[model samples]
Target: MSSVLGVSVGAGTVRLARPQHGGPHGFVPPYTFEVQTLAMPEQRAEEAAADAIAAMLAAAPEVGATTITFRSDPQARAIRAAMARRQLTNYQLVPEAVAAVHFAHATTDMREVSTLAVYDLGSSGLTVSVVNARTSDVYQCERISDISGDYLDSLVREQQIASGRIAHPADPAGLAALDALCRAAKEQLSNSNAVAMPSEQGLVLLTQENFEALMMLAIESSARMTRDAIIRSQHPVQAVLVLGGGARIPLIARVLERTIGVPVIVPAEPETALARGAALLARPAQVPQAPAAPTILPLDDEADVTPAWLTAPARRRPLAALTSRSGQNRREVSAAALTVSSLVVVAGIGLGLGYGPEVLERGNSTDGSQAVPATTSPRPTQAAPTSAAPTSEAVHATVAAPPVRQLDNEPTTSAPPSQGPNTFTVVPGLPPVVLPTLPPVVLPGFPPAGQ
Candidate 1:
């Protein structure tokens, strides 16, 4: 037996689903994983989506086939290329609305209904679609408005600001946090009579009735669009299916039900319905057959058989034909080896050029000829000792030759230098030579030593 993987790409999130094995509606998937869509360029978004799917596939390696249902054609193509690059071979595309209809047919009593409608209230916008259940064809699909869950959250945020609950309403970050809180409160109000929103000011209570009142216009607009789609389809819709993240609000369903005058149904785990439907469609109806034999065409004696494009003078081999895994690997290895070898040769040449003069001088000095001695500078000497006598001998001895020189070289035949009364001359070479200091070293998790 084989299994199918279904993926649904929405404006704000991407969801994955796979069928369960043991129920009457076993084709309907129970497992799912959702990832928020990245707010990036088109190409980056596709890459992000591919990364998410790859992660899911890594967790569940048994999925043999995949079906990706998309809200738009461009997204479908981009995501399909992403999956293809990951080698997900057995996959197909289904429109989001059609997938929803397929899901309704399989999971609900709408299987016998000829026509059905689906209202998908997403984070960014609302989509209303009327589909023919029998043909899986969408007859009328309309995007109601740009207003959505985000708009509702903003309304709540405005209310907070007007009530002076947010001190710094002008701060973008603070406003963003408040908007998130408002969205959470809106979601909570779906199941509770009142939800508390915490802020810097204090706890702000939002009742379900007030929340619905704040979003009344958007709710009414969505309901009107659903009703319009049904009427435009020109067929009686047996049932209306409501699903999406935005549709989680209880008021949306009640309003739609009252407006359309049809029994509106919110399926269990409705968010996964589109993905599960795509997975159901992706299930292989029959096993693969054996490969067919290659066809051999007869050659004509006096006719040119080659196609015009292939026979053209400027024709070149296709890029796909020129590429192969082994060839690419061999080229990459050769390039790396060449780079390393070039770097080694350049480094050797540079080192040789830099030290050539010094090495030659050392080698010449090693030969036995007398080498020139390095020049040396003279150092200052200490004062001579004086004898305590009043005679001419003692006075002459007091002004005698300088004390023994600090160096081994003989003293120069020059006049004695003048000296001060009680100070000794500072020896030029005797003062300790101070070496240059290095910067202190820093270690991880420790402070550096003092300079």
Candidate 2:
């Protein structure tokens, strides 16, 4: 028989709620009860908040209520301290910002959406918070102040005053009542043609058109802040979540959608989202005192996580096409590699020339005469062709043969030391001589008889 109490303290009234567990849905209240609305003077506005908790405990004491949890507001700290003085130990306090996030978690089966913009518009003031929607067993929480709904309300109020629908300045009491009326009218307008406001100051009509205009300021203000919050989260947002009573307004959703460029989710019982969310936080299944933070494990930081852009359909190029492109680039790279190899080979040849054997030995080995390899290596077939023009052996032999003759024919003033046949060098270019062979052909005896 686990039970918890939820209380909401507004400007003119305090709502005392007791949620009974294991009870069938659509269960009616035990008896007709009315919430006591206290004036601001007696409770000093902040102190009056404690009465709501006291009233809830008084309402249902039969249930085995182990804990009583209340929604936190600006006045939470003071109210909580007062509750502690009364020795009400089985109670927990949650900020409205955290309560709203808990509400989204309990009702909606979403987690790891670490950032949420909660816009709470009530009878008096609006409250907005950017909270972490962590999905871990030990829930984690954080808040950014920019996306507050209260600021939007002020914008709307200023716009309304500028338009001269109200007097110079709106009193607190008048603003409270008007906000309450506008809230009711806003809800009614959601499902009807025109929500009529029956008041002492005649009938004020809130049509969809008028609501849109008045809500524009709130929307613009909220949208700007929402965009800022998304940037500050430093994590990609899975959704643009809307809760609390004001979240039901269509204008609010439209503005958020337009600003965030994402879908705006509105869950059921928008008015009670924070209260229900607080109730869930109070009665968690496993409350670990030293549990890890809920949103600490970012999607980007997770080992098994893949980014949305990575998972979504991409323009996949065919492997063959990519290979072809790679081959084209590869050809260019191969050319570069060949050029570099050639340079390295040329450098080796130049270095070998400095410390290597004579050019003749290199030529002999190149001509395939030496068993030992040439000191200056030949270029590989695949290597770049030698830049040095081919030295024609025919031309070289012709030039060398003439040089040897020129050295031998060089004239000297003094004669040779040895009168060798080499000393009288005969020069060719002279006339030819004929021999008298026929006259001398006679035999020796015939020559004597003739004489």
Candidate 3:
């Protein structure tokens, strides 16, 4: 009896399916891990891939298997390293989006459907697959950056700041704390009308209305991308299918339905459908058999394929062929790339120069609107009974006066009794400032006239 292992690596969970004979397949308990560090610049996506794979392997060590399949397109080195570490050999990495296609074909008897769109809103990104329903194949997959429900959490934080509802903390501490709060709020918002993030800054309350308002952009983008995927599938979509954790969001399903003009089909356990489909693909009878003539399914025709699941479009590339080219072609492509980079730099500089002044001017205006505090002089305003108010010139002269009488030793009878209204003499060594010179005096009585 042959057995197969199917692994689905998601942002928040890693699912493993082990198909056993004559019953529901056993699944590994879901492993929850944050893809936080995976967002780092270097090797981050791969690191997330590897960490997820490791979790899957750890979950199902006892499943008798010669082959391991992955929804993630793992790099050869990473897979090899994993296999080496596990001391296992047979492995295959394929698109996770193809899971439903595999599952549909295995369990259902229908084979004529030609096109299906897979809407995958995973933890990190929103992915849509346009596939040929006939071949159990994918035509294309497109992903948007951070458009998942997790991303909606970020939108919520931004809305909070924009609405003056809350203030984010500073730097690393702030980021970590905000992440925690947003995540908690997201989970709570999923279930309740409101949630609060209690911190030293006080509680930040988020209502469902606020959450949806925050997520409008992401929701709209996801819907638009889903619609475009259906359009690009180049087939009259028989159905628009929803899967992934984000699919569980009612708002997402509603948006997809409204956008695609088809009822969003929410299959049972949509999150695990992909893993189940992969395991089903491992079954001999479930594998797609090629037609005798190696016929390519027409983009319009969704038929004559094994497993209704696998009957989707295989990956298709445009048929343009490149004839032999000289090194000049390489140089041309490089030059084009360099020109694009230069244009980007110029655009950036233009933006900075054009907007930088406006920003500075606005800052100055804001400063001007604020009241300037008056400085209180330490000298008493109340006059001594015998003294008159000093004239402005006298005050200026007094302020301009330099300190004299530096004492080398303790005070003695030799110390000067200050005279001449405490005239202050200039010190010998200090930084000096010169005021503008008065106009040169008219020559003395000697050169009268032009002389």
lDDT for model 1, please: 0.69
Instruction: Please provide the root mean square deviation of candidate 3 (C-alpha atoms, Å).
Output: 38.8
lDDT of 3 by residue, 1-451 (tens): 4445665555555566656552234333232211111233224434454555455556645444322334345444555575566555545656665667766555544355668777877667777887776775777788776587567666766766666667767787786677667766775665688787776545678887876666667787788877876777676676667787666556777777777886566765667777776665553334568868865766546655555555334322122223235456888999999999997886566445443332333334433331222462322322222555344444434334412333345454554434354344466443333344455467766665565
User: Where does candidate 2 stray beyond 4 Å?
Assistant: 8-15, 23-46, 63-74, 111-115, 123-126, 135-180, 284-451
Q: Model 3, 287: alpha-carbon shift in Å?
A: 18
- In candidate 3, which residue ranges exceed 4 Å CA deviation? 1-4, 11-13, 17-61, 66-77, 84-86, 103-114, 163-165, 197-201, 267-273, 280-451
Local distance difference test, each candidate: 0.69, 0.54, 0.59
Residue 233 accuracy (lDDT) in model 3: 64
User: Candidates sorted by TM-score, descending order?
Assistant: 1, 3, 2
Model 1 lDDT tens row, 145-198:
567767778888778667776665567777778777878888777679998777
Candidate 1 TM-score, true structure as reference? 0.57
Candidate 1: which stretches are off by over 4 Å? 22-45, 84-87, 168-171, 284-451
